[model samples]
Target: MRRIRRMLVPAFAMALVFPAVLPAQAAPIRATVKSIEFEGMAAPASVKEMADQYSTASLKVTYSDGSVKTFPLSYNRLFKTTDSIGGTVAGVAIDHKGAPIIDNSVPANPTPYVSDSPDSNSLFQVPGMAPSALGGNALSLVTHYEYITFDNANQSAYGLIPASMSLTTLDQNKQTGELKPTELNKIDFSGVNGLWIPCNGSLSPWNTHLGSEEYDPDARAYEADPKATFISPFVQAYYQDKTKTGNPYDYGYIVEVKANADKSTQVAKHYSMGRFSHELTKIAPDGKTALFGDDGGNTMLFLYVADKAQDLSSGTLYAAKWVQKSAANGGSADLQWIKLGHGTDAELKVLVDKGLRFSDIFETSDKAAEGFTAIKTYPSGKIEYLKVKPGMEKAAAFLESRRYGAMLGATSEFNKMEGVTINEKDRKAYVAMSYVEKAMEKDAKGADPADDIQVDKISSGVTYELDLAGGAKDRDGSAIDSAYVPTFMSGLVVGEDLAKADALGNKAAVDKVANPDNLSYSESLRTLFIGEDSGMHVNNYLWAYNVDTHKLSRIMSVPAGAEATGLQFVEDLNGFSYIMSNFQHPGDELLLPDPLKIEVLAEINKSFENRKAGGVGYISGLPSMKQIVEAAPVIGDDNPTDKSLVDLRAKAAAAGAKLEWHGKNKDIVVTLGKHSLTTRVDSSTATIDGKKVNLPAATQFSKGKTYFSAAIWDQFIKL
Candidate 1:
């Protein structure tokens, strides 16, 4: 056998000489296409053919001796440029089709991912990039890094930047005294802009993404005039099409992106969704009706048509009236849907009778709808049996009032809603809150101490499913579809759970029902994950919610020193799922060094004296636990007298409080009776009003139970 095998090897090697021995190969590349290069930017095109996946236009490989092989661009992966072939083509930005076009100036601003400047203050220094590099001030914090403002003094709403250029950062957490490993990357989304900042959005069945522009009065206008003034969130788009500035009256609406298309294409706003701080919207799988949450502090949950619907001028817009015990105990509430109408139809009757406003109710409907004819716009006439109850007449009337006074309190109840999504397959809607916590600090004795106050530590992220059918009932005692003002749909939920307290402040029951925050769902996993506030090491985590068992399980915990803020699933080119999260810096636990090493550190000082680990305490109003470690002050002897606390103290003073330093370097502890806050600070000399003060005020104060200190970074107060 061995001798035969040795003979066969040479025979097999020689057989390759035969022409038939070779298998058919890919057709040879033929055309000598000249490379087209953009001086400042890379071409938007990518190689589409399998053979050109890795080959670049820079390579001069001889493909089957020039068979006129033309390299084309196709979709490959998320956050990557297309492969280069033997020769590059001018990355032609096209319309919906693959044709080359001349002018490609849609929302033409250069993406924010590229640093506007390369200063030390630039986001690139943070080590972890932000969510959107283009985001302005407040948006810059979360956009640049995963940061949680435990103290509420710095809270304000901001705009969303495009996804392409996400700014990331590395931050030193104050609570855990840990250096969070910050790894950052930038993504250049082609043809994308005006991302709805960290708001709840929906994914369309067509694989596109839809979100609402939570534009305020400054960024948008909503007056009654047809030619109203408007501002473009995109600087480039704003400058080029000054004429198209939406009339203040024309702004609020849902915008849709064909995710599969080039990011540069101008997204169309479905004006049919109406003008308002259009918060969260979920399109039905059929793509007709849209369910929305109006988050201008407190407004009604609105439902609208998607332009394709017949009704444009008029359609049913329902205000949800939660029918529960206080209408405020969160989930105990139900919803009541009421339709809105333009009352002056009576005058239209007069016009039909004596001829005043118009000849008929539908007469000027055409004229009223003729305004926005850009995308086949038309107004739907008043449909009968739309059913506005006689009792809800006043409420529904005010909702439709163009009068500012009438609508003041009409919708101010729904405030600060953060997330919204729809399980299209289940016909359910979900909404959550980006909880706000405020800390208030003040001097305990004289002006010697600093103003260190924190308040509103409430964590809010709850998911409520909506029922499409209005809650009204039919004649046979069956629940009526009209009664369905989208109520909390029964299946999904998310967020932190508060620990129930008894009268004695002892642990009562687990406050499971009240505190589920930051909910995200995966249809593929058949799991709904909630971001919960885990005490000590991990401030918050992603917990899985079982729809069948109604139990919460820890799927994967957040790394130490990092709290999972934004949970988004981006489908990469390979069809794999990657989760995007904001890791707040100076995280609770120690952060491992760069190469992706992570460990959740337990609190080393968990002694009986530092408050026993029984249950979490309340920060602001939300439930939270004392973090194991304290964040070290970023200030030092060299950078002493830094304006770090100057603005903080000023802001607190304006809000009715004053601050002063308590300690010098040792962990400064602020004790308020039994409650205490501790952190590390650096030594510094201060000259206030030409008065030079040595070290922190803590050096002067004797031990006292009632006195608190603001030394270094952490503020501590007497219990």
Candidate 2:
């Protein structure tokens, strides 16, 4: 075989490829990055958690040519400010007059009270996001921010939101996919009685931000008296209706904000999806199916199926029934969904406008009585017994959803199930069991009617994965309308609970996820980004877990006492990829012991303006191939490829293709890959291997040099 191969190549062509006499050089193989990997960030020691913690971010970039290289990666914080919407820091907050709202009420600690930024940004899949009217890169966006006043001296925050969900266009460097906030304008929520406490949100399949309102006001309170103190916030600050009426039905639903090219937005609170303390709403890979976990205790796993794709205005809501499979590892369950009811958002708005009370849908009693069916349910995980009124099942399903779900025997064992995300390639979904305690553990933390989930109370928490399938049925054995439904769920990543506190007063293992809250999964990278909202750790961390490798790496540590929030991993935004992260309410972890808080509070407070702002930022090292490529070609882009060997020789070296002297006839051989060209330096024609080809220009012999004008120079690339 060796002799046979040696005979194939004109032996002369192998030697003197780049002689000392020639200025041109024979090319060697080039290396380009093919993959990247990182190591976990170190846990902060003691008070170091009070400051931002970045891991020793080292990158392993593997190239296509099988070469390897390493580099140090760093976090490029986009912005972190308590500054009001007059500038671009985070998502802005605007008021009724469409001007930035400067809520400097708390003179000691002042910052923009920015809520949830969507999981996906405006730069994502820009071609699909581009409005047909604005077919190019140019587009406009307006923003509105809802704000709360933090009275730091009093150690309490004002709960009332002056405005609702803010909408704004992000300024992005189209080439790099860098997002910068600009201006903000309030989205008038008078149609929905003003937006509630807009919390962590997700980006919809149709490019909309699906936001949440944590801790819905108790409808029963409003049922007893329409002038409840909780109702005053909206009436006084938002509606300004001195009449003093707040409709409980109007708040606590999934809010969608759709941006348009004209800088206008269409916003709606989807009542059909059921009202609960929504943590975050994640749309399934199938687009129409939506899944979310209620943020409070004794809650139920919720799923919403839209009648049409990319439409959330109307849908059928379902609650999960947990059939326990194990009592270990955060527990496993075969999930059976119970169909609740269906309705249109528009229709629900009509009912909300009518000011429907809880009493209108169900009759309640302190104890079990005639015609009153008692069921262990909620005032948020504790227990409330109620009966459904006749002919109000549908209304009860939407307006008083959790109550109706409990009455129907849905698993009310889930407590503080925070974020839901999916890995499309594996057909699996993940839910963050922020705290593996209370209702999830049998009789633990005094959770009653503990029928299902029974696991050890691990304060460090666990992230669970659900096996998804296309065809699914409810507890009644009725067909579910959509694909993307979870059939079974098991713990994917569980944190370690320590019996004693660490040096940093950490109750959970420092290297593991403590009170895992915000989660974002990148399908392309096969990684799940987990954020912490814990009292277990002195400082919350953001972690990256690779599904294939089963490697967990701590990528970042937010300020002490701050909740790691706004976690979004974008696989591709134009030409780059980014791991988005944010922290809120720094120096506000009331969960820690007073002593620990006292030690760290002052330092964490100093991290921001008067120590108020939690940050809004992202990791910056990851970039796609398109992002890393050169602006110009790797070879001769300035001169046409159809040039003489003299002109092509210079580019040949850059392209990593060989230029060789061949044969006794003074022919030259240019080899790129498997193909090569052979021609006399003084001939006007050439032969690609053995095929004859004509040259556009005649070859010439200059002083001490030979040139061949071959239009076929470009053909070498194609070959």
Candidate 3:
């Protein structure tokens, strides 16, 4: 008989309606005339746009108050190199002072070509330079992070853009027999292996940038040539026992960088937090608890509780287990947290120092039969045990966390769990799952046989909200209970017939959202911003969803072959908000239209050829909250004299509040937070929290939507 797992949906009634039913021809959401628009700023041009048609002028933003401001947004090309502080090319030459020399006159040597060599021009070429083993074109690619600072004294804003140097190699000049050094771009951070494929990151409460290293140290490549001295020492030392298999274990961890512009930035790799294909980290309001999402199939969601507030160097790591309580795909589940153990770097290093191999912690078949203690039972009914070998437990738990978690009964069954955002006020976290693959769907079904799991065949993506409130807590208010119910928000879906087109044309059946990968929430805007990283859209977009109004709007989009990433909202001292985002790998051939007319393809390819500078970083301004409210649509009956009450009901629903209408008493009551507001129709006053407060407009009602002044609506809701 097959074992059945039980599933549950937490807070099922409050689930947001999925946008899958939206019409394909729905108009793009836009701001009305009352909202401010940035003039002279041209909309993003498609690959088909002519070179001359591109706009290069600074964006002129016109605020609702008629104040005009200009933001000079442009790409910063400076990045650190071994010989220089700044350079345009991947390889740079420095002057005597160690500053980058912007000289293009160096004679190009064509003889004895080293460009094809994977190990050429690496950092190892020069002794005493930054120690890095990365090689090839990986060294040339520079990923950047943008930092903004506001000065209250001058009422001005400043920006700091630092580029993370990709992997590098040492190349020998055959003609001169001299070694060429390929250095890193940003080096203010000390004691860290250079970043490779620096993916999405978050700003910590201590005001620092935490970047993730995605897909590092190809194990097979290292195994193919184990004698290479350029291999990272961490990889070489950590996997000494597994060198034959080439399973290097040093890569895939979070790197923290200081965000202070006034001081030199410091960098540290939090290896104790566990290594995996890290997507991003969202720290809770308490500053000690953090939620980490991994970006790969069969991965796991990790939780870390720091030893102290605002410090991530030491922590306890745990893997999540989803106890099925319901059958709905992307629905809620009773979350169980399985402890994988904890330790500081100093404590864990003792085990590493003891020469314990990573594979030693696992009980072999021969050893398992010898009666080792069982750690946990796997889904396949296999029993895992802690190896009897001394000093192996802590090392394996820290170095191979995913495996250790599995031994401890934690589920590692997620499919590309990407970005995560936290709402401090609500104590909820929204996690983005890029796709519901076949295996995850299977796990959901097999987890519970009592209910049927409804999973879409052509899965797009989903955003799940995990409730962190009212859980079993410890002394410090950290949740010790593993049971958490997550509400699912289906923002993108693909139908069967349109699946092929959606894949080839990179278009979604409904344009509201597709393949959401990165998310950020702004309390001031009362909106959640979603950035797409997918091939299911012709041009990936950054959408803003007003949680209060339940309105979705496309605020920005990228060119073909590009996905919007690294979304951050920064408010200046003057109360103006700007969105900082990056466009990764644009103008790729794969982004072209499939089965298009030959002429159209020719035109598009020609345009793309001339504009193939793929990646770019941008900072765009936003409209004020009043402007957004003014742009919102108002509904009422056609009757001229019929007064309408503002649709407080809709607002209540969006805010997750309760609304009570007293028809006979001609009054409406709204309950939110610890306060209750009661008002009568055609009244200019309302009682809030049992105290009379002035209302912006008289309450009115109509056959259609209830109508009220925007001022009154703002007063009643947090928005």
Candidate 4:
């Protein structure tokens, strides 16, 4: 085995190559901070005082070759009062005649509101609305899903930003911190409201961005009067006619957005996937199977199989059941998929069009008993049960997916299913379970002790890998026997000691990952990037774990109050692979800040507090896979031999070049601009525009695939 000495270079270096041998055991890769850069104007004191305004920062990487590049970052502008649309920044008021009036006027060019409280003072005031119902004034922005077009003619990258409307502020008494009942404002994005709590999303195989709308209006209220349900008086006034006819049913679904080259967007919501507090949605390689994770207590893992590939408008949704194989916590479980029923978006839309409310599906009196409705015995010694009532309308099943799953007997014991990422090559999906509490005691009551399969202990979170290719048949004609194992478990906090944290959060440690949230994997690097959304860490950090080496390195730390999210691997046209991420909502004090010595704090106060300045921004930078594994003399069998070419193809695409191979000529050709390089396999000699040149490492064929050496990349490719 050869050892590679990795050296850190300056921030502007184009590349940094490690000496580790490829396909062989290599030394652990360590992260070195090259440089931190800031963009956009400094947030105003008013914005800084607010809990929502987190600063957006972009990271620049200097590769081993000294080529420096930065990932592009952008923010969405808020809907202003002066906008021509009838949408109002302030809340709406109902007149004496029972008509809603929107106050769309800008208040004498009012300055941004400053407040002592961490919540923003900006208000969307509705005169006739109750103050308790006024929502916060900040534009809701949360996740970013990057869509890359692979077309050579129109290669582009578009970032789809979804506003997660999780929190809103009604009027509050400044001195007493009490809710003000008279004046209230309902927050609305543009003129369109009701996009509450957009959560993590995925880029579909068709290149569309799918954003999940998490959380819903008060379920009880909606169930009572779905036609006139209002989360707040302000929301009631703002929604007006929509709420009058049961519009709450229209909000909690998955939205699909397609970005145009001009930076414009076309958006639509996929109601057929079912309405729930969706944390993540991943489309499998087949493009027909979509796995969804619900982010809440007593949630169900959903599977949606589209009627057509690349089309999610219509689908059959199913709830998952975990048949416990072991009683131990975080142990393996055999997954059973139970069909929750199916409906097309158009079919479901008819119900909404006909003023059907969520309450129309199931009886409100039965809400407390909404789990595992029917039990069926199978001949194969397997028993199946319906989590939800069987006779509910399919439209209702789509509208109230969580409830439907529950009534169909799906396991609702999983807590906070955060992120889902699929490995195309392995045909497996990785799901992050933010936390697992002991099985539902309510469901366990009066049930057979042997039949209860829920674990007995609590866990911070565990990443479970589901085998996509394997499954068995259940009596209901559904697939069972899908095996899942815990791959990563969050570190535990004990005795208030943060420094003693361990990988599984079973022990305390200062640098350990607490709550693992957003996840992304790099095939070329064989590494998984995990982002922290935990309060255990003073400053949530982003980490990278090598799948092969089992090594985890903390790469970046978010400022105070922000969680690390939107972890993505993007290949630019220049052949560089960059990690794009964001620090969401800093300065809110979700967790205790790292203890700072008085002297150090005083000294830092003289400059500025990075943590105190909160605003959303992009952070990108990381070495390419080829550079990390170039040092070893011999490649190992575990590493793919064609890894270099795979990376080269990404680089060439980024660089506006075409990379292809001519089997007849046994040559690899890369054309960029007016220059071209043609290297023949097994030949040290090559031709650059027909001029003969000696190659450093001859291209070799292994396992029926051509493998290009790092020397070819370093010597021939300009990048």
lDDT per model vs. reference: 0.30, 0.65, 0.47, 0.46
Q: Candidate 4 — number of clashing residue pairs? A: 59
TM-score for model 1? Answer: 0.39
lDDT of 4 by residue, 1-719 (tens): 00001001112212333432232233322222232222222321231222232324333443333334553332322221111122322212222232334322244442211111011111122223332434422111123211111112222111111122211222333332222222213322332344444557766766666776665443435555543333433244334433433356666677775543322345677778887777658787767778876776566778787888888888778776766665444455677667777788887777766766544565443222445343311110112233323465586478767655555666666666777777666556777665544342224554422233455443444566677664545439755323222122222111123345433222323444556777776654555666666655545555555554444555556544456655555432132344545543344333332333232233322322322222223333343434333321221122333234434465567667888889787678888655566666677545544445444456666665655555445434442
RMSD of each: 30.8, 11.6, 15.8, 16.4
Residues forming the 10-long window of minimal summed lDDT in candidate 4: 1-10
Q: What's each prediction's clash count?
A: 109, 12, 28, 59
Candidate 1: 10-residue stretch with minimal lDDT: 1-10
Error of 1 at 586 (Å): 8.7
Model 1: residues with Cα > 4 Å off, grouped in runs: 1-198, 218-252, 259-266, 307-316, 326-329, 341-411, 423-427, 434-461, 470-518, 523-525, 531-538, 556-719
The digit string of per-residue lDDT tens for model 3 on 1-719 reads 00011000011111111232234343322212221222223334443531111223233333222334453433221221122322333322222222332222234521110000010011111222333233221112123322111122222111111124332233323322122334334333324423433457777776656777554343323444644312343232222322522234544577776522222346777777876667777777677777876776556767777888888888887777666555354655766666666778666545444544434555444334554544322112233444535656666666667656665656666666777877666667777776655445654534421122244433566666677743554323455533222222332222122435643365455455666777887765455667776666656666666555444555566555555665765543122345555554344334444444233345534543322222233343343444333343321111223333457778878888898888888778887765466777777666654445445567777775555555444534531
TM-score each candidate: 0.39, 0.77, 0.58, 0.57
For residue 493, what is the lDDT in candidate 3?
A: 20
lDDT of 1 by residue, 26-104 (tens): 2211111111110111211211110111111111111111212222211111111111112211111221122212222
Candidate rank order under lDDT: 2, 3, 4, 1
| lDDT of model 2 at position 664 | 69
Query: In TM-score terms, which candidate is top?
Result: 2
Model 3 stretches with alpha carbons more than 4 Å out: 1-185, 188-190, 216-247, 260-263, 349-356, 363-390, 443-458, 470-497, 502-504, 589-591, 594-612, 624-719
